[model samples]
Every structure is written in C-alpha cells, then in structure tokens.
Target: MEDLKVNDGIVSETLPGSPPAGLESYGFDQKDTKRLLRKMDWHIIPFMSLIYLLCFLDRTNIGNARLDHLEQDLNLHGLQYNDCLAILFPFYIAAEIPSNMMMKRTRPSIWLTFIMFFWSVSMVGQGFVTNYSGLMATRVFLGVFEGGLFPGVNFYISQWYRRDECGLRMAMFFSAATLAGAFGGILARGIAEMSGVGGRAAWSWIFILEGLLSVVVSLGAYWAIYDYPDTATFLSPKERHEVQTRLREDTGHLSTEFDFKYVRQALTDWKIYIHMLICMAGFCPIYSFALFLPTIIKGMGYTANDAQLMSVPPYVCACFFTILASYYADKYRRRGVFLMGFQIIAIVGFALLVSSGNTAVQYTGTVFAAIGIYPQIPLGMAWNSGNIGGSLKRATGIAMQVMGGNCGGIIASYVYISRDGPRFITGHSILIGFVR
Candidate 1:
C-alpha cells in the first residue's frame, strides 16, 4: 500500500494537498475521537438521506402508477408486468461491480450525479411509453442508473462513520425507503388526480412530476455531497484531520486503505452467501409493497383515488416504526436479534393478510408488514457495514448485499400476478414463508 501523510496520521492513499497537523495516528485517544465522529454524523446523514429518498421514490412510483390504468392501457396480462420487473435484476447484477469500480476511480460526486440524471431521464421517458416494450425498456434503463445508488451510498457512509454510529446513520438513510413508501403514495395520488388537465393520463402525470422532482434533487446533490474525509474541499484542513482521526478511532482499524483482495474474498466466501440468503428472505416483503401495494389496496373495493390515498397511511405507519426500531437498535447495539424479531412480526402480518377476509383487517396487516420488515433493513446493512473494512472491499460487500436483496425484487414483481389478485394467497404465502 502507498503511504501518504495527512496531519499527523499516515493514510493509505494520499490526497493532493499540503498536510495539516494534530491528527493522531492509529491508536488515538478515544473520547476526543468519539466527539468528532458525532459531529461528522450530522454532515453525513442528511446528504445520504436525500439521495436514497429519490432512489426509492423513483423505484417505487411504479406501484402507484399501477393503481390507475398502467397495466390496462398497455394490455399487460398474467406475468407480463412481472416479466418487466424481472428484467431489471439481470442488468442490475451486471452493472453492480463495474459501477462501484468506476465510482472508486472517479469521484462519487460526478459519477453518482451522472447516474441520478440518467434515471431522471428514464423516469421522464417512462411518461411517454405507449406499450409494454417501451415500459420494459425504460425500467431496464432505470435499473442501470439506479443499481449503483444503494451500494454507493453504503460505501460512502462506511468511509466517514464509525462502526456504532453507522447503525443509526444507515437507519436514517435507509428509512428513506420507508419515507418514500409513505409519502410517494400521497405525492402520486396528488399527481394522478391531475389527469386530463393537459390531456394526459394520471399515470403519465405521475411519471412526469416525479421525474422532474428527481432531476431537481440531483442538481442539489452535486453541490452538497462530498467524496471522502481528506478530499472534502468544503471542510477546513483541521476539520479534515479531526474526521480522519475520529473515524479511525471509531472503527478500531485504519479507514484510508483500499483492499481489492478482501473484495475478491468477500465475493467467493460461503458466509456472504448466507448473508445473501437472509437478504433474499426478507427483501421480498419490503419490495412487494414497492411494486404491488397500490394494486393490493385497489383489491379492497376502493376507487383508484381512494386506493392511492390509502396507500399513504400504511407507509406512514412504516416510517414511524422504522425510526422507532432503529433508535432502539442503536441504543442496544444488537442486530441479529432485532432482525429476526422483525422477520417474525412480518411473518405474522403476511399470515393475517392471507387468511383474513376482512378488508380493514387486511389493511391492518399491510401496516404491520411495513413496520415489521422495513426497519430491519438498515439494521442489517449497518451490521454488514461494520464487518467489512477498506474502501474497495466495503463497496463490493455493500453491492453484494444490495444485489442479493434486489434479486428478491424480481421475485416480488412476479409474485403478485393479476390472476392471483383479490386473494393473493400464493404471493403472501411465499412472502411469509420466505421471511422465516
């Protein structure tokens, strides 16, 4: 490894600037470092939350659009919609490693902004698609752009935050999924209600408005987000030294190193497969809401508008529980038990949804499913983040986790077939069993 001096510490990779002083080397004083890391958390969390919120909103607006006539207009049948959903994963898997590799070499600011812009364009293009083929192509393009986001954010957070702080920070970031789950429903309903104002379908309006929103947010992220601790031009040299020393102290290991061999080892290891298995098992329930909740809400004898509006409440409930769960998980510093506990709650919720005939009861189950499963996601990510070290390896590990969980995205897309609507027993059963 190449050694570069910054402040009083030796970094594995050097930045191109004059060094600052007062950065303690590895084995620094613990209390001072802890205080610095807490300040760093304030800088990191909001930036990550914004990106992930857009990432989730873009991925999931499809569920809201389905409530109107997206399926009917395109003449989709049986597994055709599911098939469109499935196509994204192959491209997502293909792009995962390469995107992270490129992000590592290039600055995250440029690459991540480029990615957001592409997805925003794809989201806008989705507004114009007239057929299943066009929608399919757009979804694929969306996947190619967005596949890097979660992994990239994961890698970025790991770079600055310490092991313990990561749990809460990651929780706040991943809770964007829950927030999108909550608020996207409201936003979609408002947008969908704009139908015929300019001679367009509600679904088209949904796409156009959301796409434009993403485009605006991407512009701000380019200015607000930083690459790494030492390279942050916005922070003064003293602040950079404080960040470097603080993170190293928090992790109990040097953070400046980039290790490719560890990444290869992470890829080949059997334990990582177990981690993948856990991700697959849980991610389905989470994604089913993203891809199918609007349809499921419509099955409950409500108008399209009512269903869209109703979708908001369940996700809002999810946001509350996700935050609550994260706060407690961080307070206790426990992960596996928390994850398993939520899975069991989710299993019960799915069971209730499948077996209950009452619409209100089933809706209650929907709320539980979101609450039970969503919070565990960030907790799981923080758990995995703490276990990995070095920039390249951490990036690869996070990418693997995201790809594994998202593999369930394809399964989720297919699980709720139109034929199985009204009583989506097969899909719910599969989701319930998978969580176990």
Candidate 2:
C-alpha cells in the first residue's frame, strides 16, 4: 500500500524501513528521524518519568507507611485508612478535566510546574499529619494539584509523537510509576533506618524526604520542560521542523488553537464514555496494586522490612513486560487487542491469588498483577487519544476519560480492607473482574 498524505493527496511509494517519502524534503530521513527520536527520548521520557515517579510514589506511599504502623500512630481504626484514601479522588476527579484544559490555554511549562510544586508540598505535608483530619486536609490539596499531571502529560507527549509511535512512549511513562513501586520499596526500607531521627517516625520520613525530591525537581522543571516541539529550546530549527513533519505525516493539520466546539464535542461524545469504561477496567486494578501492594505482600507473612523489599521485584518485572508489550503494539500500530489479550494474565494471577493457600503461590500472583495491569492502563490511555483527532479534542477526550477512569482509584481504596488479609480473596476475586 502506498503512503498517502490526505490533505495534499500526495502518494509516496515507500520502501521497507524508510519513513514515508518526502520526509527527506524536510531533511528528515529515517536516520535523522531516529536521531531526533533518541534526542526526544533523552529530553522528554526520563524527565517526565522522574516527575511521574515521584507523584505516584507520593500518592500511594501510604501502602508502605502502613507497614511502619501509620495506622497505629494516628489511631486509624477499621476503614479510616481506606476512607482517607478515597477522599483524594473526589477532588482529583473534579480537578482533572479543568486542569487538562488549563494546561492547554497556558504554557505546560507554567501550568505543570505549578501543579507539581503544590502536589510535592502536599506530599511533604503528609509527614506532619497528626490526625485523620490533618491527613484528609493535605489529601484534598494533593488531589487538586496531582490531578493535572497525568492527563496533562499524556496530552503533552501526544503533541510530540505521532499516533503509531506513541504506544511505547506511553508505556514508558507507565513504567516510571511501576519503577516508583520498586524504588518506593527501597526508599521505604532505607527510611525505616531513620525511624527515631529528630523524633520523627520512619513513615514521617518517608513522606518528607521523598516529597522533598519532587519539590526540588519541580523547581528545576521550570527551566527544563519544553512547551512544544516548535518552541523547544534544545532542538535545532531543522530538528524541530522535522519533528513537526513526522507528526504531520500522521495528522494533516495540527491546530493548537482552543475552540469551544471541540470542547463541547468532547463533553457530549458517547464514545468518550465508552472509552471511559475501558479506562476504568485497566485503572481500577492498577490503582488497587499501587495502593495496597506493600500491605498485601506483608500479608504473605514476611517481616515488614522484607515485605517492603519484596514489593520491588514484581514492579521490576512489570516494567520489562509493559515496555515490551507497548513496543510490539507500536511496531504493528494495532493496539486494540493488546489490552484485552494481556489482561488474561492478570485474571489468571488473581485466580491463583484467590484459590491458593500457599504464600509463594500468592507471591507469584502479585508478580502477575504488574505484568498485566501496568501495561494495560497506559495502553488504554494511548488507545483513547489515538482514536481522537485534533489536539484540543484529544486533550479534552483524554481528560474526560482520565477523570472518569480515576473513579477506579476511589473504588481501589475501599476494595482491599485490612480485614481481608492473608488470602484477601474478596479483593483478589474482585480484581479478576476489573480487567475483564
């Protein structure tokens, strides 16, 4: 099949391993494109991933802090911990679509850094929470600030990469959060070493020190984050144009302009709601894993420190599998079946978790959780955005779906009550259905 540019109806007889013809007219051959992509990889992927890593860590680090007696310290009883976790989402969901749209109206460099700094402050503030109300107050602010970053970053990256190339990049961003699970464990265990320092508990240190890094990184982001491909200070003019040309090959016209019609179209679209269901399916389980893995691992009868350390491996495994799945999905440009197919792994894992009495067997199930859930959520987001057209509409659609999707986070908070420990059959059984 010939590669056709729809707007001009220019057909290119493309050979294998070459970019669509006329990329050379912009001095963007396959080699130049690959070079430019690596440059983008260096600039965008790691930096955004670092920010996401910290955000994800801050959001769910309570799972680790719980291992250090966060419940006992605050007199948290029964479902208070669960309810506290749930409170963040209402504010988070309320803020996301507005936040996503705001990032578009202003510079992402301006909007996102503001978002990041405030959330980092919330992260730091969690360390000082002496009671339930204090924790809830900080979570309210955390929710309002943290809501913007995920959907905003998803839209930001979509601007820089073509649809077919986005799956792996999206998964890499997902992998950053998984790496945070691994890194969070390492940090949690190390922070445990500082338990009595300055009259603060290890859990307090967990919130303070990890949150401090995000605060620092957020400050530097004002300098580091590029607004758009056209305005990237690090890129040569030819490189920037070449990047734009590649995106244009996928989309005929790039309109960054804000229009109410697109916003209204996104608001009323039934397909966006269907896509929201897909987001819920993937995300409910991913959030379940993130917010409870340490507690879940400890239920397998390992020591608290050992459970903290043990949570690391499954995330490491997930990061590898998640990237591999996205790579092939992007390579083929057929992401539709990947989410549904890989989800079976999670079902099987959960089934093992529910039916098994053995600790090692259940540990294996946790490993499978990441393998399936981690990749599916980001791939789900990529699938949602790739189907939508126009940057404004895509951002709007993404924000809507993400806001709806995080309803799963609220669900996730309540699913694994502390009483369901040891087997946690109810939570595991419920997880089997989330992917389905």
Candidate 3:
C-alpha cells in the first residue's frame, strides 16, 4: 500500500516503481488496457447506443407520421405541424441543466432510466392525441424527459474513458442517431402498411410500438449500465483502482463533489461558449435533415414507400463516415481539421440541393449532407468533453453545449415549411448560412 495524496483536487496513490504518469504507470499495460476496453465496449457501448437510437427515433418519428396522414388526422394546417415540431425544444432546452444536475445527484442509471421511461410514455401519448394542443403537450413533455440524455451520456462516457480514447466511442454512441434515421424509415414503411390494425392509423402504430420498445429497453438499461469508476461493480478491485488512477493522471483533477464553484466556472468558461456555438452550427442542419429527409425525397418524385426507403441510404452513409472520421481524428489528435472539412462537405451538399433541378443530383446531395453533418456531432462532443477537466465542470459544460445546440431543432422545424414543397430553396439556403 502507498500513501494517498490530494493534489489540485485529484486524489492519487504514489506507487513505488510505477512509471511517473499515464496508463503505463497505473499498471494498465497495452494488453490489459486493450482487454479492459474491450470489456467496456461490450458492456457499455451497445446499451448506450441502443438508448440513443430509441431516443432519436421517438423524437423524429413525427416526420415519418407526416407521410402517413398525421397532419390530416390532427387537422394541422400550414405552420401548425411545424409548430408542433418547434414547441419541443423550449421545454427541452429548459430541462437540460437541471436534468444533468439531477443525474449527478441520483446516479446515471436511475436518472437516465427514469427520464427514458417518461419520454417513452410521452411518445406513446403522441399516438393518442386528437387535437393540436394534445400533440403540443406531449411534445413538450417528451422534450423535458429527453433533455438530459445526450449530455448525460456524453458526460458519463467521459468519466469512464480518457480524453484521447473518447472519439470513436462517442462516434459509436452517436452513430446510433444516424442508425435511427435509417431504421426509422424502414420501420415507418412497414408500420404504414398496418393502417387498420386495432382501428388506429399506421402513424399511430409507429409511435405506440416505438415508445413501447423504449420502455422495455429502459428497464434493461437499469441493470446493464455501469456507474463511475469508483463505484462500478463489474470491475475487480485492482482494475477499479487502476482505472481511477489512469483517469486521475489523464485529467489532473476529478471532482465528484457537488460544488457551485465548478458550475460557475463552467458557465464562465470561454471554451464552453465556443463549443456551444460549434454544436449549434453542427446541429441546425442535422435536425432539419433528419426531420425532412423523407419529405425531401418524396418531393423528388418518389412514392411514400420509396421516399422512406430512400431516406435510409443517406443515414447509412452517415454512420459509415462518422466512424471513419472519428477514428482518424482520434488517431492523429486533430479534431479541428476534420470538423472544418466535414462542415465544408455539408455546405457543398446544401449548395447542390439548392442549385440543382435534377432529382438524382438532389438525392446525391442528401447523401453528402448526411455523411458530412453526422460526423461533426460526436467530434464536437468529444472535443468539448476532452477539454473540460473536472467531472462537475464537464457535466455542466456538456449540458450547456447540448442545451444550446438543441435550440437548432426549433430553427430546423420551421426552415422547411409546408408551402416550400419541392425545392425548399429557402430552407437549404438558411442551412448553408448556418454551416458557414
């Protein structure tokens, strides 16, 4: 046993014969570290990815419903449908900081599971709403419940992995959203065929079934997800100590204490604001594309089923490109170049969509846009999380970034309005401006 000394808020042990610092000093040699990370990937990544997949599907399924007469059933005219989409973000943005604070206090499993359960219930309620007000109410509550998930998961993953190791893991987690877009299209196509089942519309069945899936997954998450390194039950005592020591060496500080000072620090940090702006720029086009891709395809002269099927390829392309970009970004320790490059790709995509009258050319633009935009999300999140030192500061900073970024969803909901129809030049031009 060695003496435990506290330096700059980090508590670490001084082990004799340990290399001065880093994972090697903590007895996590390459083989052991690789094996441990593999275990974590198996245990943690899949579950977290699944949660995000469902979260995105629930949030954006309204887009799919639109193809199946959701607007008609609810009597939504003109901007009313857009209003339903826009209303979600106000409550979503308001709840993030508080929900993240609650996650810190109550533990990730409990806080996340509770939110997942409620958000799913809200999704289910969206199925039954008969009027615009009912739809608005459900959307608001859905936002409130889901507000914490992205940042909470980002912060939670930051605790378990070092900064350099986070990029691909963040990609793996975030690619689920792209996967949801792909899967949502196929699922919606199938569900649209079930229009008369139980006397409910096909669109209604989409919400009900997807929401039910979320509930079951939330229950499983309670048992599957691990907490912080110090409290994780699956690791051996030796492994836990090594893990914590490696992290302490990596960051130089890890404050689990609930302190307002850290909150103030996060709020005051210039990097936090810069990261928030980056997130906003990255997310604006993403939310718009996710919500409108099927419609955009349909406007290109595809039938409803063909449009839904067409939406899948862009998302699939996005999932592939996101992983590749994150891998190299982590390998070279260069995020800024990748971020700028991908954003440029998206700008090109939007330009193509706006300038071209040919349907194939516009559809190709969607693929470019998806691939370009999806990679930046995980890259931005990992970049921001990597810079923040303390656990408390990281939590607050991530929440702030996500909260600000989600405001883009409100902007997106309105950009491609009903009247814009086939070309939507205004929406594409607006997105291009934001990306630039």
What lDDT score goes with residue 397 in model 1?
A: 72
Q: What C-alpha RMSD separates each model from the true structure?
A: 6.7, 3.9, 5.1
Report lDDT (Cα) of residue 376, candidate 1: 71
How accurate locally is residue 343 in candidate 2, as Cα lDDT from 0 to 100? 92
- On residues 1-436, what C-alpha lDDT tens digit does candidate 1 reach at each position? 2332221221122221312333434443556556666666667778778778888888888888888788888888777878877887777766777788778878888888989989998999999899999989999999999999888887788777655556777777888888887778888878876888787789888888889988988887787778888988766787687778767655445444455776686687555566666777767778887788888888888888888778887777777777777677655556777787888888878888998979988998888888888887887777666666566776787788878888888788788888888879898898887788
Residue 93 lDDT in model 3?
Answer: 91
Model 2: how far is 316 from its true place, Å? 0.2
Compared with the true structure, all predictions reach lDDT values of 0.77, 0.85, 0.87
Q: Which tens-of-lDDT digit does each residue in 157-270 have in candidate 2?
A: 999987767778988987998999999999999999999999999999999998999999999998888889999988999888888877765665656579878888788877
In candidate 2, which residue ranges exceed 4 Å CA deviation? 1-27
Q: Candidates' TM-scores?
A: 0.89, 0.94, 0.94
lDDT of 3 by residue, 83-154 (tens): 999999989998888888888888888899899999999999899989899999999999999999999999
Answer with 2 or 3, whichever has the higher lDDT.
Answer: 3
Off by over 4 Å in 1: 1-38, 233-236, 250-259
Candidate 3 error regions (>4 Å): 1-23
